[model samples]
Target: MQTRNRVAMSRRAFAGSLGALVLCAPAVARAQSSGVVRRNTSGFKLHNWQDHFDELGKGIIISDTNSRVMQQWMPGGEMFIYPTSVPMTDELTRRGYTEITFKDPAPDWTPTPSMRERDPSLPAYMPPGPDNPLGARAMHLSWQYYRIHGTHDTRKIGRRSSSGCIGLYNEHIIEVYDRTPVGTQVKLI
Candidate 1:
């Protein structure tokens, strides 16, 4: 009876350790994949390359795939980072550089002919409202069929879910929309 109890305790201990390792695997893999090592320090910390922060702007959007976040740079180095939805394939968001061409409030959604052809189930047009995928506000990008817009499904804000569009929470969109103007530069890497 003593030997059996010892064996059971050992098994439980091993299982707990295994579970801990499994829970940490994703974070470990993400760090490995990005080649970014985060450390605690008391002094100055060097972030990304200096060139990435060289430019000054009132309207610049930087989308980082590895971190799954978007940083909006306002003039004088005011930066706001928000979680973003990204394309499944990097190719869609990898367009070297682009800019916001226009913006709309409660924008009506119309499926591009190509999108309609690709997804036969998609509606030809969806009026501006709750059912519209482009939630409360939208910023049309120079690239075809892509927009920085509010998403009805806030659950997808930090995930790789959109075809190519950059999605923000509805309230977040309203804040950004009020600040950003047409022709704001957008960089997705």
Candidate 2:
């Protein structure tokens, strides 16, 4: 019994030491995204890169496939690195896009026209409803064209699959939307 305890203790010590070593590695302190910056997060995810901080003010530049070039704030250096992009650029503009316009007010993401069009078989959007995809609010970047918004589907949070809009968990997106406006520049490169 005593020997087994010692083995367990040793394993824990080794894991702690290895974690410390990884955090202290040169990989953490330096910029890996060309001119883009990197910051670590404490959110519980197994991947190191997925631990990147969230800085919505920091805009993101994405590849054609919706893959991102790390993340940075608009007009500033504050940023974080996320592994995914909303609707990802390619997916966003892939089809059914009209000229950009400013929606008079935010629309419900659940039963809205765009939502129905995207998924005819899916349920509808009703404001302040629990399943509302728009969560609390969505920053209307291009009228109905695109947005950065809150989501009820938290499981989809860091993945590349989205309509053509960026998805943030309800809390995070609401915080961002409150600060954004109709003319805000959303550059999906």
Instruction: Identify the candidate with maximal lDDT.
Output: 1
Over the stretch 60-111, how does candidate 1's per-residue lDDT look in tens digits? 7877765667777666545555667777677555555788899999889987
In order, candidate lDDTs are 0.73, 0.49
Range of the 10 consecutive residues with the lowest summed lDDT in candidate 1: 37-46
Give the alpha carbon lDDT tens digit for every residue of 1-189 in model 2: 355434445888899989898878645744557554443433322222223324323333221223422232443544344433356335355432222234323457555476578679976536656767666665555444566556778776666667666666665554445544444434443
Which candidate achieves the best TM-score against the true structure?
A: 1
TM-score of 2: 0.53
Report how far off residue 11 is in candidate 1 (Å): 25
Clashing pairs in 2: 58-72, 58-73, 59-72, 59-73, 92-164, 110-124, 110-125, 111-124, 111-125
TM-score of each: 0.69, 0.53
